[model samples]
Target chain A: MIQLNLHKTLSSTGGKMALDLDLTIEKGHFVTLFGESGAGKTSTLRMLSGLLKPDSGMITVGGTTWFDSRSNIDLKPQQRKVGYVFQDYALFPNMNVRQNLEYALQKNQDNSIIRELLEFAELEELQHRKPETLSGGQKQRVALSRALVQRPEILILDEPLSALDLKMRIKLQEYLLQVHKKYKLTTILVSHDIGEIVKLSDSVFEIQNGRVIKNGTAADFFGLNKTSAKFRFSGEILKIQREDVIYIISVLIGNDIIRVVSDPKEAALLRIGDQVLVASKAFNPIIQKL
Target chain B: MSIVCVEVDNGEELMSVVIDSPESAPYLKKGKKVNVLFKEMEVAVTTQKELNISIENRISGVVASVEMGLLLSRLILETNIGEVIAIISTKSLKQMELVERIEVVIMVKLNEIILAP
Candidate 1:
């Protein structure tokens, strides 16, 4: 299990506050950190990665003690087996897609692993393409491939989908799930979009004013009341289309075609011509993707 | 005469009201109900302005268009206010909730706004 107890303070455009958090995540778990802008999500990630030292606290990953203010032990980021994917899809502009990923395999030098990552990311054809030439979705796939190339014990992703356009975001989300399953790496995702957290995270940690307010499952995170009417109609699965990272599915219900926020699994079940049911108290069906 | 516009998403449509303020512009409450313009183009008490944490409500719409990976979904509204655009993240078709239209009801917290003369 990954246990994190951290407290830090930083001055930013947003107001400042004391950040105190204590979290325990099981192995192979997908945990998402969600909050509004300046909620300290990025700070938490920075502390874990050793890029920023905490004011005071302890951090342990996979039985390894990374930081401890009391014992005065702090490991450099390079020594920690961590794979980080930034929100902007940080790929090398000077290098092609292939070289960008190859650089990540520093000591291991596993060519076969690189090939596997390329195949999994559906980039076999674009391996030689430069980062600038590839589309946003393609670039994200490359970033994901690079992050996993090292096969780090822990994966850190900060708003990985926020930078992509809707369709690319959805496509990359599916690819991310695949990578998560294939590697089973303990992953931590920081996102401001609530829907993204609901769709991708198994567990969600709500951060506010430099503290974790609540930690619960995806359903709980959305406050799904068992008595609510969300299940009144088992909305039919429709045909799913991928633009880039966003998936748009068309469903036929009575005569209305309602679109809801979704992932690849839901999109795949939808057929171009099919019927689906949707039920909600309020008829405001606006999928706001931030 | 003083005028203020208010937008309300009561379950489905995005309704708007433009009416004369009973109090001075300084005393007008943004979220509180006041007189509003009705269909007859006259002032009515049925309308109200919402000043809260988030000004807009959350709703589901149809994926009308997609360009360069950005998907644009059009929401069918029942109000006179018109359409709104929201970005979504995901690719799973099963969770897509593919009905041509879906409705959502969101809670509104109050806020404060000043109309400039």
Candidate 2:
């Protein structure tokens, strides 16, 4: 388990603000820090990673004391076994992919772990490629692989996929899940995207003005209550065509169009340019690949 | 009974039957329209190469996004029928290897469709 009750003062462009956070996270769970800019999400991560010292409070992980203001005990960033993947790829321009990962290894550590990580990250084919030649996704993959070389108990991801496009972001989300499960690591992520937060996190802490304002599961934050049997979307009716006893109705939702079939009696009530919502119940909807 | 026809993307069309009642008369009177609603839990997604089912409402589209919850995953598909959201088991998601832009079919029964003015 990870426990933190930290207080810090941050100086931002707006002014100085106090950041007070208290959180406890179970092991092998994915937790996210969600909020707006300068909401102290990054500050909380920095404090946990030992990059920033807190003004007061205690931080304990799995019975190990990383910080305690009363005793003035603090561990250096290097002393904490944390795997941090920053927003930027942070790959050494001069080093190749394999070398970048090798540099993160502790002295006297076995070199075989590098091979395992390369395979796990699917970077084996690009092992000798330089960071300059790699795509944004590839660079981020390299950064992720390098961070795991130490087999750290805790994994920190700071918007690692923010630079990628939607397609790439989806791909990396899968990889991140694989790595997190394989290592059984306590993962903490910072993100602003609601979809990403819902897809990746087991729990979320909403931060505001450097204080934790709310904590809950993704469903709670997304308001995905399961008791209801109704779904709705608004669209403009585009066309109405007659086919035998049924009328084929067309509606435009955003840039896409949906076709609906209705009885003649019901069709008589609708016309082109009409706005309507198509709702459905909890009946089974089959999904098949094309 | 009132029927509303909707045209989604790719020229595909769908129809919804709106049961006339005092509460729905104003919204369905003649011109005003609003968003569509369906139970979020009623939607299901699959990544199989082919599907054989009796559900009459079948639309094909690329996956727009996937939101994974503890037990369920919310999938948004950009089909010719528009962007439809479905919730499925996480186990099935991993088993089918469903990801963005992968073509899949979404099926909904006709009777379950509700129309809001």
Candidate 3:
């Protein structure tokens, strides 16, 4: 279990604010911190990893005190068992794919994990390719694989898949789940993807103005109580147009963008770049072999 | 009708809210034997044991197994009454920890109980 009671003064584009957070994530459970940008989601992760200093409060992971303001105890990032994956796929520019992962290992650490992770992430063929030569998705797979070399029990992902396209992002979500389950890691993710949160996280914390305002199981927080929808597809809104008293909304699902007709009210609620779930009855589709 | 469903691992009690089971009203009695009939859409799964709700008949069962889909999830519950099958939102299953071996309470309304003489 990880317990965090942290206070930090942050300076960002939105202005300075005092962040106060009190949260607990059970072991082996996936948790998400969600909110608008600069909501202190990233800051909280950084503090927990010991990258940023918390002004006061306690941070405990599995009964070990990582930080205690009253007692003036703080562990360095290297001392804490944390594996961080950033949004940008922060790989070393000069190192090849395998080398980037090898760099994350501690001195005298066995190199077998590198081979295992490469195969697990399907990066065996691209191990020799440098970071700049790999595609965005491949780079991300490398980043994720590298994060696991240390076998850290606490995995922190800061918008790791937000930069990839929809298809690639989804493929990587599977990889993340694979590593999380295989390693039995307690994962903390900072994300804004509602569908992803509902699919990946056990619990969600909604942060606002550097404070945690609402927290609950993903189902309750998003009001995902409607169990009647049997046919559902998550996609992004690309365009909205009107046709003869009705609205046509275009959604990008996987590689194909399909147009769905929606009522005027629901069309008005959707905007470009918004993630949406196109749901209907199960028997509506006529499947054909191509 | 005797509904025979094979039980699986998740403990012994799971809860599902069954509705829209409008039975033949003439068949219900203390000493009468009747069959219950309902469609898959009529059953809803929940975790509440005791609460204020419209459901009248509560059958507590344990989650036996789950077949998960993209949006909906199918769960089999083993109870003293019998094995009940329910469909629920996938999100609810993941968040509620309603996997195999977990005890849950399944509920149904009085009017939803169909009785066939």
Candidate 4:
């Protein structure tokens, strides 16, 4: 479990922002901090990783006290076993993929972890390739693997996929999930993209002005059923039949064809191929259990 | 009931809809000219060719644009009927592989249809 009650004062050329936050995250939970730029999302991550010291308050992860301002107990960055991935990937241009992973190892550590990470990230084929020769996606994989070489208890990713294209971003999301599950690492991601938050996070904390304003599961924020009392579903228009002035429109909704009655004037506006929404607030929609 | 004229791009006759007043149904006889309206939230979008639900309003159109947000994506489609907008999850957008010009189906519940004469 991770427990934090941190207070910090930040001053940039823009102005001063106070960051006062209290949060407790369960172990192995994929949590995301979502906010706009300069909202202190990255500051929170840096504080957790011991790269930034809090002005006041405590931060404890898995019973290991990383910070306590009152007692002046602050652990060094290297002392905190955290795996961090930055947006630029920060891979060494001079080193090959295998060398990069090996360099992150502690003194007297075995090289077996390097081989394991290379296989886990599917970079064994390109292990000898330098960072300059690798693609953007490949460099990110190396960075991720290098971070994991330490077997960190906490994994922090600050917009790691922001630089990649949509296709590569999707692929890396899967990889991140796999590594988080396999290693049982407590992962914290900073993202502005709602889609990425929903796709990966178990819970999301919405930050505004350097403070956490809302917290909930992805479903709570985006579930369709939560939006209304009326019945809703997506389907396609299949056929339109005219009987006198009333038009019957056939809609295919998941293998079921439903016919709706409409007036000729209203029906005239709809084509056979037009995507339309069917809704009614008058009656209670029946729910059948299969 | 509120009546509004909808202009279609294909030069079809102007479409009118009566909205919010269901009591106007009795006066809406055959061949009667009336306007139709439905709540925006009542609309849903899907890429599936077939669905098993009992919804009545189903229309297909080509995707015109998709505005992706952190949680919801606004999709606009141009169909023969008119331009329809849908707000769905970004996850669904990706899973459906919905992009500009892709054909999709829009569904709405029957009772949610509001008419104004």
What is each model's TM-score for chain A? 0.79, 0.82, 0.91, 0.79
Clashes of 3: 16
Worst 10 residues of 3 chain A by lDDT: A223-232
Model 2 agreement with the true structure over B1-117: per-residue lDDT tens digits:
545555545766555555453364555544445444444445566555467876656677788987665666778788775767776777788888889888888776555565533
Q: For residues A1-52, write the lDDT of model 1, one tens digit per residue.
A: 8888998877887656788888898899889998877888888888888899
Ranking by lDDT: 2, 3, 4, 1
Candidate 2 CAPRI classification by DockQ? incorrect
Q: How high is each candidate's interface RMSD, in Å?
A: 14.2, 13.9, 15.0, 14.0
| lDDT per residue (tens digit) for residues A1-290 in model 3 | 99999998999987799999999999999999999999899999999999999999999999999999999899999889899999999899999999999999998999999999999999999999999998899998888888888889899999999899878888888888888999999999988888788778999999999898999998667754333234556777999997643467899876679888664546789899998877543434578999
Number of clashes in model 2? 39
Writing each residue's lDDT as its tens digit, candidate 4 over A1-290 gives: 99989899988668999999888889999999887788888888899889998999999998988999988899998889899999999999899999999999999888899999999899999999999998899999999999999889899999999899867887899999999999999999998655677778999888877788988886454442232223544445789997533467897654467887664547789888565556544354576799
TM-scores of the models, in the order given = 0.58, 0.62, 0.68, 0.60
Candidate 1 regions exceeding 4 Å error are: A228-290, B1-117
Better of 1 and 2 by DockQ: 2
| Selected candidate, larger lDDT, 1 vs 3 | 3
DockQ each candidate and list the results. 0.05, 0.06, 0.02, 0.08
In model 1, the Cα lDDT at residue A88 comes to 88
Interface RMSD score of candidate 4: 14.0
Ordered from best to worst DockQ, the candidate numbers read 4, 2, 1, 3
Per-prediction fnat values? 0.09, 0.12, 0.00, 0.15
Please tell me which predicted candidate would have the highest DockQ against the true structure.
4
In terms of docking quality, model 1 is incorrect
Lowest lDDT sum, 10 consecutive residues, model 2 chain A, at A224-233
Docking verdict class for candidate 4: incorrect
